[model samples]
Target: MRGIVMAAPGDVRVEEREDPKILKPTDAIIRLTATCICGSDLWPYRGVERVNHTPMGHEYVGIVEEIGDEVTTLKVGDFVVGSFVISDNTCEICQSGYQSRCVHGEFVSQTIGTQAEKARIPYADGALVATPAHPDPELIPSLLAASDVLGTGWFAAVAAEAGPASNPHPDFAPRMRPVDYAARPLPSRSFDGAHSAGSLGVAVRRGARGGGGPGASGGSSGGGLR
Candidate 1:
């Protein structure tokens, strides 16, 4: 298989590499259907972070090609989206909805780069979410986005306490329109109200320069600005 490797700051090349194999009992291997460069990938590309022949890319969606003995939740040919963070979801922290902070968690980008034909995924049961069926080719990009960008936006919305009851000023709605559209796959009604709260934060920050906008004068309360 071939993969992207950052030889140095501002230097990247696609080179032949050994095919990834399951190194742990909890691992799985996926043949990448789509992969993307994330904002964090720019850190090393721009010299802000060190890179010595480092593999690149983290966000991806792929078809499961193989699995380890411990990876019972998935099977061959499953279309899957994986988290950038590797974690065993059975951990106490994961049970509390903080899988990213799971005791055994690690960032995938640091070891396994997805910008290739195939890649190894650790903690497969916890880190990979399978779609109900094979997705259409057109939906691959959106599903790939869910691997990171959409998840980040969703987390941002949740942290902001966005919920169904929140009403955002119409003027700020456009700012969060992308998040709203990307969040369509999510089942939470809170996402509908999340757009308002997410945008309101921006509105409040800008309003600080002048006077706060209507309903943006106070901290978020019940997912709405007071």
Candidate 2:
């Protein structure tokens, strides 16, 4: 398979590597159909984050090609979406709706980055949400966004206490994407700099109700923590 790998700061290359396989009972091997280089990948690309070598990418939407013996709920050809953090999803943290802090959490980039032909995903039963069917081509981008940025944005909105009564009208820079309202600049606000494009959606949902205006900002990273 070929994948984007950062050899060093400011250097990225698409190189050949061995394919991934199920290594554990809970693992599943996926043939990537779509993937994206997250905004965080720019950290290393721009030489801000120090690294000698690193696999790139995290957000992924793929078709399951194989599953471990213990895997259930998903089968070959299942199209799935998952968070950047692989988790058992049954842990205390996961039970509390904080899968990112799952006791058995693992960063996707730490093992099999998603920017490739294939990837081995751990906790398949708990980590991935399969789509009902092969999605419409037009919905692919939205589905892919749900895997990371969109999910992050939703979480951020919830954490920021954005509700129906909250107004999220922050003046954004001219170049900011309108759909990405969460990435806008705010006047005076302190928030965890972590969330996706979905944050603005949540804010809009809440703003439909009434009350204080909510403010959202995209995080430094796309999927996982910065």
Candidate 3:
């Protein structure tokens, strides 16, 4: 299989690499259907971060090709979305909903590159979430966003206490995609509400700073403000 490798700062190549295999009981191999370049990828490309033959890409959506003995929650042919971080979601921190900080967590970008035909995922049961069924091709991009950006925005919104009553300013409307997708139940509305709340927080802050009108106060009770 061929995967992306960053040979050095400002240097990237698609090179032949050994196929990935299950390395642990909780591992799973996925044949990537779609992957996208994340903003962080530019760090190495722009020479701000060190790069020495590093595998690139972390955001992905794919079909399960194989699973290890311990991976019980998924089966072959399942369409799944995985987090950027590999985690054993049973840890106390994960139980608290911070799987990215799980006691046994690893960044997928640091080890496995999804920008290839297939890649092995560690802690498969914990890191991957299967869709109810194969999703529409058009929804693939939105599902892929759930892997990272959408998740981050949702978390930020939750931290800010954004909710249904919170009114996000129009200027921040473009940031409401999570909310729109959430309405369809493809992922969940909580992610949407939180993502909207997070964006509302930004709008509120700007309003408080005199950037917008007085209506920003409507979001204050929704925890859009500190």
The better candidate by TM-score, 1 or 2, is: 2
| Distance from true location, Cα of 120 in model 3, Å | 0.3
Global lDDT of each candidate: 0.67, 0.65, 0.67
lDDT by residue (1-226, candidate 1, tens digit) is: 9999999999999999999998999999999999998878888899988899998877888999999999988899999887776667676655544555567876667688988999999888877877778999998988776676554554444553355666543443555554363343233334322112222212212332453433333221112112
Per-residue lDDT over 1-226 for candidate 3, one digit per residue giving the tens place of the 0 to 100 score = 9999999988899999999989898999999999988877888789987889999888889999999999998899999887777767676655545556567777667689888889999888877777778989999998787776655554454443345666643433445643553333222223322212222222322333454422333121111122
Error of 3 at 173 (Å): 22
Residue 109 CA displacement from its true place in model 3, Å: 1.1
After superposition, the stretches of candidate 3 with alpha carbons farther than 4 Å from their true spots are: 164-226
Q: Which residues of candidate 1, in runs, are more than 4 Å off?
A: 164-226
* TM-score for all models, in order of appearance: 0.73, 0.75, 0.73
Candidates in order: C-alpha RMSD to true structure:
11.9, 7.4, 11.5
Question: Candidate 2's residue-wise lDDT over 24-110, tens digit each?
Answer: 989999988899877777776788777666877778889999999999878999988766777675665555555665677776764
- TM-score top scorer: 2
Pairs that collide, model 3: none
User: What CA RMSD would candidate 1 show?
Assistant: 11.9
